[model samples]
Target: MTATTPPAVSMLAPARPRRPRAARVLLAAACAAVFLWPVVMVAVGAFRTSLPGTPGGWTVTKLVDTYLSPVTYQVLAQTVFFAVSVTVVSTLLALFFAWVVARTDTPLRRLVTPMMGLVLAMPPLFFAISWGMLGNQRVGLLNTVYQWLTGAGHGFFNVESWFGLILVSSLKAASFSYFLLLGPFLTMDRSLEEASLTAGAGRARTFFRVQLPLLTPAISGAAFLTMLAFLEAFDIPEIIGIPAGIRVLPTQIYSHINATYGGQYAEASSLAMCLMLIILALVAVRARLLGGREFTTVSGKSYRLERWKLGRARWLGTGGILGYGLLALVLPLAQLYLGSLQSLFGRYDGFSLDNYAAVLDDAEITGAIRDTALLAVLGGLVTVVVCTGLAAVLRTRGGLAERLVTISVWMPMALPGIVLGLGIMWSFLSVPGLNQLYATIWILLVGLFIGAVPVGMRAAEGALAQIPRDLEEAARIGGASRVRAFAGVVVPLIVPSLLSGWLLVAIMISGNLAIPVLLASPTSQTVSVEVLKLYQSGEISQAAAVFCVISTAMAAVGVVVGVVRAVLSRRTLLRGTG
Candidate 1:
């Protein structure tokens, strides 16, 4: 009988790569220049101590001034409070909901994950604008209904308060945390829980003593990452906190650049550096906390957990899921729809298509829409290509330089949007010939591209990691070029995941408010920036209309892409079948 090669043996066979060393070096250099250099430029820009367009010598004066200011201390303390509270509240909420879905016999459990995904996909800018309308104290839907029900003269609720800021932020944060924790819950082994129950422990005691400890690592990791996200949050804070006189690091940096008359480029750079340092320290602590402590539930082999029979509590679980969907997704979107049909923001008696028509007819809104579309497509594709190329290069190439380049490509994970935007702006301005690039649409493109690198890189790397090098080796041995080998053998294996990731990246770029706020000029403004301008310009009803248009478009694209991805993911080739 003819002997066939064992799968493991074939996978471990030595292989020669056809890719040229010079080409690899050049590609690595290009990636570093695009994805890595701008980060270093952030620190370099902080010490420039000059106006953005004007040339000047480097100095530490601005950095020293920002570091010594008492107001900086106040902002720091408040930011910590806000970040910590949001983290705790969001984590607890996600843990509870995730448990209801993953551990218990929650009715309609499958619906929970998808709904949360939708919530996570909905941009914070959309919520900030929606809630700004829903809780306006004067004519907000909530307050309007409240006064009618209670027979009060004035509405009591205001979204522009500490309570509102945290509420809005926590809702967004919880959706993300739920997804992060869901995988852990799903993968957990049931032996410990089974043992605890057999020993006559109550469910509560078992959860607290046995299961919760197993989940502590995931919970802690989620908390730190969530804290970092909100630390540089701008939309909710800018819309809600500023009216309450709340100053977080992100908003403070924005004020220095855009809110001030002439703009303080030097001060903005200094503040960006400070926030950068703070996030770096947090990231370091998080790394230390998680190092060598990735708690795996499966001991030796994987086992399944039977969903607890919750008896009558299953309906209660379903109710909780419905409640989250109502508040997080349904209510705000409902308010936005209702508000969009009105000619005036708060008036409810009469409705019109005038706002929609006007928005569609306006040259500026149309321009912004066109610009947003161009950027989302161009930026998303560029990010995916560059990141995909980097992932492939890392898999085959080995050197200290390549590893350093790899780190640089992934370093944007710790960066907040406005900080990175400021860095890019300063980086552009610091060079003489490139100063003109700052005022054009191209700068926003670069900012958006880099803003997406960390996520895109991770997605690409994860996809590439799953694919065996053996397939590519076989292709190379058949006389295929390295590029041809990858294109022929590896791309098909990971295309669905890559396409799914690319779609999400495109949506994110479409609705991105923070980066565009810093980098966009009047002519280059995107749909998201237009929404803010409309709202802030006292054109609330029109702003709602704009959001409705964009959200509807994005949602349709998301649904279609999701379906295509699902179909593509079903290919048997992905599973080593036909």
Candidate 2:
């Protein structure tokens, strides 16, 4: 009998065979084509004289026309000013809240942590519509209260103005910045603060001289990130800025592409080029200078965090924290819920379920709800899988190849939502084979996956990084193939982070408006798109009704996910002990 060789088992990673090998190759190509190609196409579209779908040679005429226009400079100035204002105010607020939560013995501080997360997840459209109705000059809730209480003839606030725009966007920026800074604050060693205190510094003095300085890098990075976010902000800008006659770059892009007739796709592409120039510069500073460089005071050794005594001041700090929670989340949600019940906004006619009935009974709206739910759950899973695969592939390589992979994974960071949507739309329309996917739900799915890669990968990398490389190597040494080792060893270890990341992606996808606004067909309409249409068409109460349903569902899903994670964790512990 012929001697039979052992079946394949320990194939090296780069030469892995059959299904796993094909998957790795397909994923890598998809990562490149999805993230990198669209931006390149945007650049191509900028110079191409033809509109998005037609054939034409490249030229600089559109680019020059865009730059030469006075409106271009005006929009640029306003965008910079708006972004800077939000960044500064939000960063300061985030810093204060982060400190309050991490170092001080403030009452109910632990609760503030989750409050910020919920605020961060709540859609920008939620804030925009809720605040819009609340701050309406004529027949708004706030105005009605003001008139009743203060005997004022007219309400002072108009949400269609710059002040309203800044307030809504700043609240969101602060919540997100606080979330990013919180992790660093919680993990930071307190040795420097202790040393400063022992060296005759008062608590206030130590906080400024030591703690603040130690946190400078993290704070600066958060500030920059916040600026980048406000730059790309679409839902708030479109809902508020457009009505105010304010033109941020994103709104400009939207207006151009959705203009009269066939629209100025080329002009919009040129505008996108301008926005991308700024974002790409910021992304370089963030990814290259700060990426992977730990700015923490110390790491790898556990240190007890000594909480600062608040004396009689705990109540003040706690109240402040709770007040922000109320403002950031509770107020908007309450106003939204109230609006949904109101027969008409600003009137105290007996509450009715009329608006909810109208929203829920609409065929289009029901379809949108189903689409949003599917995209959030299924699109979120697909994105997590793609990102996790990319992370796994990169972990096996080093130097230039890994750097290229890193850059590709984060490519979405350099493109604003409107711009990316434009690119993806134009890309699908331009490419022959891809044209088949255009105007379909699948296109929006692609956008969500690519849009979510940066976030999903960060969570995956953090979880994966915590595991020792030797553990995977041990599995390999025991004759497991790379695929088996990764599946059996790595995935089980990172389940919690994977699930957390998956939830984040889902929340983002459900709330995301810009990408879907550009990409969705009537059949593929998402809740966000429908919400915008409802709000725009003066169905104010109906819009609120739609949003309230989505918000409640998201909260329920989040709670279920938290319970599952907790149960899985407990079972793992129990099994290990047994």
Candidate 3:
């Protein structure tokens, strides 16, 4: 009877940590205070006729009146129209291409995959600028090419309108949705389809009846994200939409704050509130759709590798993939490279290195690039560390505090960048001594940091969830302290995830446009803002050169990182066996 004693439980486990828990609570509260304080001040100021101590009367009634005005409604409608169009168009395009590459044995998939990644690395504004350079009404480079080729007239390149804006936005954003859906396509269980086929169903019928049903989550998620992306778009629409008399919520807010309207902070705040509400509603719907139950199509069991015979259709599908890759990646990048080499617009008299020389020679341009690189490197490292810390704490704490922190990190992701930047500006500028940072490069970094945190946290959280808790328990039982256990065991285990998180944050920070535009000064201009400015001034050649340099450099860096990651992963796998 005395032979079988149950496993001893440690009654003297770590005390319910009062100091650590209280400090975490206080830190979270303080961070929240810093983040939301600006929006609160703007909200209050938005209602008042002027600053509280100014001569005019102060009242919340003004906010109501401003929102109800006819002009606001018109702008709101235009914003919604553009966003919806972009979302629908982009989602469809992404779905078609994803199916082509994932379901069928499409040709050049390896090449197409890397190209999509490259395009994703470029900011949205870059596409608008590239298109503008080649398609603007009077001096578009593509129109010039057409004239040279087919003797076509000048009226063909009319990207200065709403149609052009929508097309460019949708095309540029489609890459991300394509990437999102690829995951589902790769992991989907083939047996489900085989079962339908074995039951005498046709291939197309089985696809529609079985495969598509399992992919609903991925489809829904991509559409939701695309909608958010289109809704919050600023740089592309601002650059192209203005010429077509099209105004979205972001540009309207910009006009309210920066245009000759004498700085209507109150009205702008009200508009921002409206934008926040719309985004929140979308986020809520998306969360509800993606919430319950895992959608794991792949399970560890017997299976069959099913492939459809494309025959003649195979080449056509392959051609489509190649065409998209060329249009979306090759052509644009080629234009950028060629434009960078020529010193002046359409002056192919001779090639000169002056454009690149000028970009490098200017102290301001050099400084901005340096600042951008520094921010990307530092911000990426910091964001990954924070994300890993939060993910670790959440695994251990699993309470109200964990839930609150998780939600707080995602809050910034839901708010548009312009909205968040405006809130930060309003909140910090109103403070006594903090306004000095408003006009500096630091502001740009802070805004990017806010944007970076949410995505980084999500990536790290996904990786952490894959790890088993037994690893940590085993370490603790071996006499390791909590911090030591995490550092020695958890950190090494999640290195691949940490590196991935770092890469994502870096790419995002490198291409960020909205936050940098609002935060950077004339002297502290980033490459993205510079490209927009050059495009606006009809300096197509210069803009193209700048873009080429940046993109090429980034692509090279990405290759290095990818190789390192592959090596590290292999090493880890080998060591685990040993």
Candidate 4:
């Protein structure tokens, strides 16, 4: 018995290997610096009495002065008002459409999902431009049509007003909420509704008590996101608000930066800081609201989804869905295409191919097209790679390093693109050797990368969550190095999601104007910036033409990606079965 003192160590026992803590700490610190450097630069600028390029002394006078201005409060109030209005309208419309398509047996239900993708692919900037062409009071297609049908002396529509701004913004915002809410709507437990019905609740009452309550988290989350979107929105406010004498925080910041006699950098920085604080507050509130409870509906248990039958009202539901498509998608695109064919200011003298011809012939337009394509591809690749790495590390690790990395990746979500652009500009210009990147395409790439990485991280995290850790563990246990195990076991499983995330980021980058406006140099201009210049310079049809080309390209890409995804999925299913 005394000789049995030492037992043989089992080779199968789990190993508590010490990971490289120093490497993780360094990586997290680097990522945090990348994410927060611009923000810190912006804060420095906001507090400085002078601009970065000039001699500056640190002070809070700018911040105090901005707060003391009455116009600041007015703009803040209007921003809140616009954001709240858009959120409410978008959320209600999204709920209705999500319910109609996901819960009810609506006609063309198969088309609803793809159509929503198409709607989302069309950028909000394009929507603003299209609506501007459709409702410009004087030469707008809608106004022209209204005048023709009713024989009115004056046009009946004006997109430059608050009503028009809210309507267009709400329509765009609704598409996002629709996509976000659709998943939850489809996956929610039908047993809850059934139980309510059995307990003497009518259909409508059951929906309100059982179905809607279960969807509260989804609804609230979508609303908060939509609100932030509207708050940070630059295209809509810049395009529609300026002409209507409407000023929101984003547009106001734009005005400050683009003011005559070389813009006020300090003031712009102060405004950006204020906007950042507001967004941070909103984000904090959202986290607080969602932190306390679990909202998952799907589980290991098998459950059947029971689609509601609307009887004859199903046709009405179908009609409602089609109507939304008509308004949100078909109508604006049609107006854009038709308007692009018309002369400048959408003159109805006769349609011509001149706008398209000009777009093709213009060197700047061609250059912008090429530049946009490059930016989309390169920026998207970089974002995906960085985000995937960060996500993988965070998922596998724990403690302070992991937490730091998580916080760093998420910091961009609270910073608007405009603020990001401004901060990046300041950051590059402030440094000694780095100042060379200030006006180059690299700056724009950096800005877009920061803006898009957060989304990619979220997408990657969702994909990684579906994969089991045991696969990697098994490979490790089989004498495989950690790198080899990750490459062989993890990469293949997550490729589809990574590809999807990359495509999404590319599409978004191609359409983004906010970041480009503040960062792009003359030679580095993108299509969105070109479109804005054309519109601002009153080249209406040409702007429409450029927008039409870009939108068509994006739509075609969406279609191709969808088809490819379908084919790959089918092949995968076949392989599994075989």
Local distance difference test values of all predictions, in order: 0.85, 0.84, 0.77, 0.85
- Model 4 steric clash pairs: none
The parts of candidate 4 lying over 4 Å away from their true place are 1-10, 13-17, 294-302, 555-578
Q: How well does candidate 3 score on lDDT at residue 361?
A: 85
The ten-residue window of minimal lDDT in model 4 covers 7-16
List CA RMSD, all candidates: 3.4, 4.8, 3.0, 2.7
Query: How well is each residue in 205-284 modelled by candidate 3, as lDDT tens digits?
Result: 98788877788888888888888877778888888888788989988877777756467767877888888889889878
Off by over 4 Å in 3: 1-4, 11-19, 34-42, 51-57, 195-202, 287-302, 563-578
Tens-place lDDT digits, model 2, residues 412-528: 976788888988988898988989888788898988878877888987888789778888878877779988999998888788778999998898898889899999998889999
TM-score of 4: 0.93
Which 10 successive residues of model 1 have the least lDDT summed?
A: 9-18
Prediction 2 TM-score vs. true: 0.91
Q: Which pairs of residues have clashing backbones in candidate 1?
A: none
Q: Assess candidate 4 and give its lDDT.
A: 0.85
**How high a TM-score does candidate 1 get?**
0.93
